[model samples]
Target chain A: MTLPAHGLPAGTLRRVRIVGTGLLGASIGMALTRQGIDVELSDSSPTAQALARDLGAGRLAEDGDDAAAPELVVVAVPPDVTARVIADQLHAYPTATVTDIASVKGRILDQVRALVEPRTLDRYIGSHPMAGRERSGAIAARADLFAGRPWVICTDEDTPAKDLQHVVDLARLVGGTPVHLDADRHDAAVARISHAPQVMSSLMAARLKDAPMDAVALAGQGLRDVTRIAASDPALWAQILDANAVEVRNVLTELREDLDTVIGALDGRVDALGVLASAIGAGNEGQARIPGKHGTAPTVYSTVTVLVGDKPGELGRLFTEMGEAGINLEDLQLEHANGQQFGLAEVSVLPAARGPLIEELRARGWTVPE
Target chain B: MTLPAHGLPAGTLRRVRIVGTGLLGASIGMALTRQGIDVELSDSSPTAQALARDLGAGRLAEDGDDAAAPELVVVAVPPDVTARVIADQLHAYPTATVTDIASVKGRILDQVRALVEPRTLDRYIGSHPMAGRERSGAIAARADLFAGRPWVICTDEDTPAKDLQHVVDLARLVGGTPVHLDADRHDAAVARISHAPQVMSSLMAARLKDAPMDAVALAGQGLRDVTRIAASDPALWAQILDANAVEVRNVLTELREDLDTVIGALDGRVDALGVLASAIGAGNEGQARIPGKHGTAPTVYSTVTVLVGDKPGELGRLFTEMGEAGINLEDLQLEHANGQQFGLAEVSVLPAARGPLIEELRARGWTVPE
Candidate 1:
C-alpha cells in the first residue's frame, strides 16, 4: 500500500514486532503497515496470528527469518499476562525498545520490576491507548482504532529520552496523540475516570435485575445512559478491575462515603435537603469539568430539537436540509418517542447557530417548536 | 386554530383549567387549546400566567368568567406544593375532576388524602407525564411536549370510572400513551428507574470534583454516559429525592450492598472473582431488559460504523445515501475523534441489513472496515 503523504516518513519505524495478535495488536500492525512500515505479528495461538496475517495486519513472525531485528516491540495482551510477555519481549529483543499496551500500568510496572533486571527495565515503557470497541479479537481490529485517541505513555525519571521519543513516534505514526504520565497517576486517573464508572454502572444496573417489568418499562434516557456500560464483558472487566484493585478501591471507598451521606439524608438525617442538594451540585460542577469533543474545553452547545417521523427517508431529508443551510452539527442525539411512529432529533450546534438553524428547519416545513 | 381531526372531539372536553403555568401546565394548556378546548390558564405568579396567555397557551383565567365550569383541573406544580394545590383545586371546583402532574405520586396522594375529605379525594387522581426538557418555564413549553411519551395515570380502587376515563382522554388529547399504575407502584417505579439513577449518577459525578485535570482528561464515552444526567437541576432533584426518599433509599441501600461486596472483593476476600463476575453479570441481564425503541421488546440491531469528515453536509451525504439505499436506521451514534477533523458515525440497522448496508457504503467510497 502506498503511504499517504501525511503519514509517517518511511524510516520513522522501518520494522516493528507486535506480540499477541489480538484486537489492539493486529490493529496497530495494520495501521503501521498502511504507513509503509514492516510489521511482524505473533501470538501464542498460531491460528490467531495466522488469521491476523491473513487479514493483512502483518506478515507472520517466523523464527530465523531473513529480516532485520525489530527496532521496537509492542506487547498487546490481557492484563494478567502483560507483564510476563513484556519481560520475554525485552529479553528476546535486547536492542529494541519495549512498550506494553495494558489498561492498568502500575500493576504491570510493579510486576515487570520484580521480574526484570534494572538494565532491561529501562527498555520497557508502559502505555495505554484510550480507544476500544465493545467487540474484540482480531476480526474486530481496524487500522484506525487509535486515530485521534489519547495514547497515554507512562514513564519515570530514569527513562532514556531516546527511548521515550521512539514510543512517542510510534504513537504519532498510528494517529494517536500521546500524553505523558507516571504509572501510578495513570492508574489512579483511569480508576476515577473509567474503572470506577464501570463499577458504578454495573452496580446500578444490577439493581434492575429483579425489578418488576412495569418498573423497567418506565426506563428513560437517564437510566439507559447510566447503565449502558453495564453490558460490557464481565471476564475482561474482571481482569481490569482486579489489576487496578488498589486505586479502584480508593475511589470506590470515597464514593461509598458520599453514598452513605445520601443514604443518611434519605433516612431523614438533620440537614437532609442540604446533603442531597450538595451531592447533586457537586455533580454539576464535576460533570462540567469534562472536556468536550476534539479534546477542547467543555462547550455549551445550543440544541434545536426537530420532530422526525420514523421513516427511511425522513431523517435523510432533514439532515440534507441542515447541510444545505451550512450548519455544522457539533453533536446529534436522537430520541425515539414511545409507541409512536416518530422521534425527536436534537441537533446541537454553536450557540450562534441556534436561532438560524431553528428558523431554517421551520421554513423547510419541519416541526421546530418554539 | 383548526383542531386536527385526530384530536379530541369538541364535546369531550369543553373547558379545562390548568393551574400553574410552568412547563408542564403551559404545555398542557397549549395542547388542549389547539384541540378546540377552552383552556383557562392560572398560576400563583400572574406574570407566568400572563406569559402563558400571550404565548397562546390559553386565555387567562379570571374570576367570574363567562365560560362554563371547567370539566377538569390540572395541578401542575413543584413536588413540594403539589398536594396542597390538588386539594385546593378539588375544593374550588367541587364537580371538576382534578389531577396533579408531580413526578412522585405516593407522598402527594397521602398528603392530599390528609388535606381533603373522601368525597373530595375521589375527585382527585394522580398522573405523571414521562416527558420533559432540560429547559423549563412557560417560554420553553411546547404543545407537543408530551407527544408519544408515556403519561402515567395513578389511580386507586376508589377512583371513579368516569373520573379515570376523563384523565385517559386528557392524556390521549395531549398526544400521550396512557399507562395505568397505582400511586404506590408509580412511586416505586420512578424511584427505581428515575430517582435512584439520578442520585447514583450524581454520586458518581461528585467523585470527580477533586479529580486531577489529567484524570478528567481521560474521560471517555463510558464516563460521559454515566454522568450525562449529573447536570440535572439540583433543587428540583432534591425535592424529588426527598418526596420519594423511602423507595429511593431502598433501591440505593441494595446497590450499596453490592458495592460493598465488590469493595470487599477488591480487598482480597475469598471468591472475590465470583463476586465481581456476578455483579457485572447481573448488570448485563438487567440492562438487557430495557425495551428497545417504540416500546418494543429488546431487539439486537447490527451496527455499521462509517468514518465521516467533520464538516458541513458530510453526515447529510452519508445518511442520504442510506436513505436512498432503502435502509432505515434503527439508531445512530456519533463519536468525534479527539483533536481530529473527523468522527465515527455508528449507524444501527436491522440485523438483516448490516452486510448489504456495509457493502453499499463501501461502494459509495465511504470507509467500512471488515
Candidate 2:
C-alpha cells in the first residue's frame, strides 16, 4: 500500500533511521521495512543494535560514531532521555525530519522547544502510538504493531504542515489512525484514560500484598482482570508516570475526591450516597460508552457457565462451536478446577444466542451439565 | 466425582434442594449432579424452574407448592429478600439444613436467626460464593459456576458439625474451595476482594460519561480493559452494597483514607511522596501474593502484538498457534483498527517464550512485525 499523502514519495525518501532498538523503535522499523521502506537502525548499546539487526528490523548505519544523520530520524527513547536525544540529533543532523515517540507529549514538546533551535523544532512533531505490551526491548517489537491503534500527533502552528504530514505518513504506514490534538489536551486525555488506569491498577494490585493468603487465594478474575495492567514494567512506567506527573497528579486529585465522597457515603454522611452513586454511575456511563466487539456497545445479555475439562482443546471446542454457530461471545471465564477433572467455563453471549449455543454444545458430545 | 468425605458422609443424606435457579443455585445442582447427587429444584418464578430444567441442572420436584423436607436446603435469592426467604424455609422445613447464597452473609444470617426457630437456627450456615458476574438471573446460571471459586461458609459453634459438614459438602459438590469464617470476617474479606473492586470499577467508569467524544473515541484498551467490570447489573449491586453496609462502609473508609493520602501526595504535601510510595508499594506487595495459573504465580513475560484482519478465525488462528506452541497467554487485547485492513492483536505471554513464538510465527509466513 502506498503511503497516504503524508508519506514521502518513493524516490524522494532515501533513509529512515530509528535511534533506539526498544519495543517501539523496533516496531516502527519493522513496520516501515514491511512496506519495503529502506531504513537505518542505531542504538548506543551494541547488544541492542545486534538484536535489532538479527531481528531484521534494520541495518545499523556506518556514520554513527559521534554524529550521524538520516533522511527521517525517529527518536524512540525513554521520556527522560527524549529531549537530550532530540537536541543532540538536531546538532548532528542539520537536515532531517525528527520526531520522538514519547508517552507524555506536553513536557517533551516544551523541553525540546526550550532546548533546541526554532527552525530545527519546526521539523519535529510529537506522536504517541496508543499501543504497548507488558514486556519491553527490541525483541518484543512486531512490524504491524501500530495497526489501527490511535497514533496521536501533537503539533502546533509552528509545526510545518509538511513535517506534520511526514509524521502522519509514518503513522499511516504503520497502519495507525491519526489523531491530532494539542500537546496539553493529549497529556490530560491520556492521564484520564491511559496513565490513570495504569496507576490505578498498580495501586489496586499493591493493596493485596498484606492480605491473608486465603484472601489472596480467593482473588477472582475481577481482581486479576483489573490489575492485569499492574504487571507492566515498573521501570518504564516510572518514567512515563514521572514525565506526566502534573496531569496525572491532577487526575489523581479528582479521583481522591470521588473516593472520599464514596467513603463518606458508606460512613452514612448525607448526600455522600448521591455523590458516590453518581461517581459509580459516571463509571457506568463511561463504561457503556465503550464500543464492544462490533465496534459498538451492544447490550451484554449476561453470562452463563458450562463445565468443561481442564485438559487441552476444551476451550478450543467450546469457542469453535460458538463461532461456527455465529454466536458472539462478549466475555468468558475459566474457573480453574484446582483439584477436579473439569473447570467451569463461564460464557457471556448476547441475550438471544445463549439457548441455541447451549443446545448446540449439548448435541456436540460436550457435557453441557444438566 | 463423589463428594469428599468431610464428616460422617453427611449422614445418609436423602436430598438437598436449591430454592433458586440463578447462577449460584444452578451451579450447586450441577456440581452435585457431577457427584452423582440430584438436587430438587424450586423457584418462585416458573421461568427459572423451566430454565433450570432445560439446562438439566435439576428435576422439578412435584412438591413444588410446599417446601420439601430435604436433609439440606439452599436458599439462593436476591440479597434483600434472602433473610425473609430463609426464615420462611425454616418455618416450612424445620429439620432441614439451611443456607442462603447472599453476597453479604452477616446481615442476612443475623436477621434470619432472629426470625427462625432456635432448633432450626442451629441447622443453618450462611454462605456467600466469592463468585458472580456482571449478569444474573437463571438464564445466566451454569451448574459449574463455583468450580475452584471460594465458598465462604459463615458459622459459629452453635452451628452443628453435621450441618457444617453438609454445607461443606454442598460447597465441595459444586467444586468450590470451602473457607470457614464467621459472618463478619467473611463479609470483610469479600469487601476487600469482591465488593470493593466492583465499587471502584463502577466509580472509575462513571467519569467517562462526560468525556469529550474525541477523548472517548480515543479510549484505549486500558480504559476499556479496567472498566469492563463496571458494566454490571446496577440494581443488583445496589442491594448487595446495601446488605453488606457495615463491611462495605469500613472498607470504603480505609480506601478513602488511602485515596486521601494519595491525593495529598499529589497536592504537594511534604510527606506525600512517601505516603504515595507506600500505597503503591502496598499494591505491589498485594499483587505479588495473588496466585497465578496452576495455583502458582507464573512469571508474566511479554505482550506481543499481531495485526490481523477483523474477520472470523483471525483470533482463532492466533490462539491456536499460541496453544499449539504450549505457550499459555496471560491476557489479550484486540484493538479494532478503526476500519483498517487489520486489527492490532496484543497477546500477553510468558517472557521467555516470546522470541520462540515470534520466530515460529515468522516461519509460518505471517508478517511478524520486527
Candidate 3:
C-alpha cells in the first residue's frame, strides 16, 4: 500500500478498505492510493480482488477474515448488496467510521436503520458521488475519479459533525467537490438529471437499432452525441433502475405528458405545439443555465467540414496547418471510408475564425469540396 | 453571376434565385455559386443580401423592376413565408422551375399544388438537405454545407424525371448523397429521428435553466453533452415544430405511451425498467445498425484521463508523448478549466490499450490518477 504523498496532515488517512472492487470502488481506491493513503481492497469475488491487486489499486484483504479496523471503510457494493454489507461491517468493525456510496441514499438509510444497532449509525454517513462511467468492473477502476466532481454527502440530523468532516476530507483527498444535500433532495435531483437521462438515452439508442441501414447511416452527430451513454452495462444498470424504479417512473411520466401534448398539437387535437414548445423551450433555457468550467457558459461553435486523405500523418498535417494559422479549434469530427480511400473531417472553430480559416485552408493544398 | 466553372452540358445549372439569405439559403448559394452556377440572391431584408454578397456566396439580385428571370428558383424561406413566396414567385417568374427547401415536404407540397400552374409543377422538386447548425443567417453559411450529407428528394407520380435529375444534380453538385423517397415516408422518418430529438433535447435543457445555480454548477459532461443541441434558436424551431406538427405530434405521442409504460413500471404497475430497458435496448440495436462513414459501424472507445498542465503547447507535448509511445488515440477530450491550474486531459483508446496507456503516462511523469 502507498503512503499519503499529497502532504496531508500526519495520521489523517488511516488504512482504509473498499469492500467492492467495481467501477466506484476501484476508482476510490485509485484516488486515495494516489494521495499516498494506505488502501486495503476486498470483494466477495476473489476475481475482483485479484483484478484490483494486479492493477496495483490496493492490497487484498484475507478471505473471510475481519479486516483491520481502519479510520474509514467505504461500502462501495451494488445497491442490492449495500445494506447487508454495511450491517455486516458494523458488526465486524465497530470502531471505524463507515459510509455507503449508493445512488439512492434514502432506501439504503432505511435498510441500515432497520438492520444495524443505533450506536453504529453515528459511525456511518450516506453519500453518492455524482459521477460514473458507462463501463464497469475492477478492470475499469480509475483513480482521481472524483476530482472536481460532485460528491453528495447525505447527512441526517443525527450525523456527527466530526464524522461529516472526515467524509469531507475523504472527498477532498479524492479531489471531489463535496456537496451536502438532504437524502431526498439528492435522490430527486439525480432522478431528474442522472437516472432519467440513462433511461432516455437507452430508449433513444434502442430505436436506431432496428432502423434501415441507409437511414441509420444518415444518422448525424446529434443522435450519436445524445445516445453515447446508452452503451452502459445492461446487468448493472438493470439493478440500478430496478432499485430506484419509483422516482425514474415519475420523471418519465411527466416527460410523456409533455410529449403527448406536443403530439396532440401535431394531430390538431388541440393547440399543443405551443405548450410543447414552451416545455421544450424551458428545457433549452435549463441547458444554458448549466455553468461551464469556473461556472461560466462557454460559447458554442459551429463545425465546418474539411476533406483530407486517409494516409497516416494526414491528420497531423491538418492540425499543424490549423495551429500555424493561429486558429483555435474547439472540437473535431472525423469520418472515413470503410477501406480508407477518402474521408471528411469537420473541425469546429469560434465564429470569428470562419472566414479567415476557409481562405487559409484553401491557400494550402487542402481540397475542401463544394 | 459566375457560371458553373465545371461546365456541364448547357443548362445543367440554371440561374437560381433564393428569396431568403439565412443559413440554408446562404449554404445553397455558396454551394451553387462555387459550382460556377449563377444564383441571384433575394431576401426581405437588404442586410441579409449584403451579408451574403460580402461572403461572395452569391450576387444580390436587384428588387422590383430589375428582378431577373431565372431558369430555376428556390424559396429558401421559413415555413411561415413558404406558401406566400411560392405564390409570389409564380406571379413574378412564371417560367422558372420553382421549389422550396422547407423541412416538412408534405405541407408545402399540398399548399403549393393548388396555387402554382400545373405545368410549372413539372419544374419543382421538393428537396431538403439533412444538415444544420446551432447558428443561422448568411454569415454562418459554408460553400460545402451539403457535402456527403443526405439530401431527401420527395416526388409523386406526377413529378417529371427531368425535374428530379435537376435536383439530383444540384444535390450532387453540393456533395450531398441524394435519397429518393415519397413525401410521406420522408415525413415519418424525420418525425421519428430528427424532430423527436429536437423536442427531447429542448426539454432536457429546460430543466437546467430553472435549476439552482449550485446544483447547476455540479452539472458534468453528461448533461452538457445531452443538451448541447438545445442552444438552438427557439423561435425558428417553434416555426419548424408548427410546420411539422402532425408527424412530430404522432412520434411524441408514441414516446408518451412509452413513457407511460415506463412510469407504470416505476409505480410498480408494470415492468417499467424492463419496458424502458426494452425500448432503450431497441435504441442500442438501432444505433449499432447506423452505418458510420463509408458503410462501416463506428467503433466506440472508452476514455482514460491524465492530468496535464494548463500551459501553452502542453497538448502538443502530450501528443508527442502519445506518438512516441505508439498509442493510437481515437479521441481526445481536454477538460477546460477557467483557472490556470491543471486540466483533466482524457484520451479515448481502444479497450485493449487503456491500462497500458495509463501505466505509460504514469511512467512518463504525467499525473495519471488511475
Root-mean-square deviation of each candidate, in angstroms? 2.7, 4.7, 4.4
TM-score of 3: 0.87
Q: Say which docking band candidate 3 falls in.
A: acceptable
TM-score (chain B) of candidate 3:
0.83
Task: Please identify model 3 stretches exceeding 4 Å from their true place.
Answer: A1-11, A63-68, A295-370, B1-11, B62-69, B87-95, B293-307, B318-370
- lDDT leader: 1
Query: How well is each residue in B93-210 modelled by candidate 2, as lDDT tens digits?
Result: 7677888888888888789878877887887789877777665766566666776767889888788888888888888777678888888877877777777877777767766666
**Residue B57 local lDDT, model 1:** 88
Q: What is the iRMSD of the candidate numbered 2?
A: 3.4
How much is B44 displaced in model 2, in angstroms? 4.7
Can you write out model 1's per-residue Cα lDDT over A1-370, one digit (the tens) per residue?
Answer: 5353454574446788999998899999999898878899989999999999988899987778645778789999888999999999899888889998989999899899999999999999999999888778999898888988899999889999877877998899889999999999999999999999999999999888899998888787788899999999888888899999999999999999999999999999758888999999999998998878878478789888898888887887888888899998889888887788898898999999999999999889999876
Model 3 CA lDDT for position A79: 89
Please give, for residues B251-294, the per-residue lDDT of candidate 3 as tens digits.
Answer: 66666666666666677777655665565566566666555444
With a 3 Å backbone cut-off (N, CA, C), the pairs that clash in candidate 1 are none
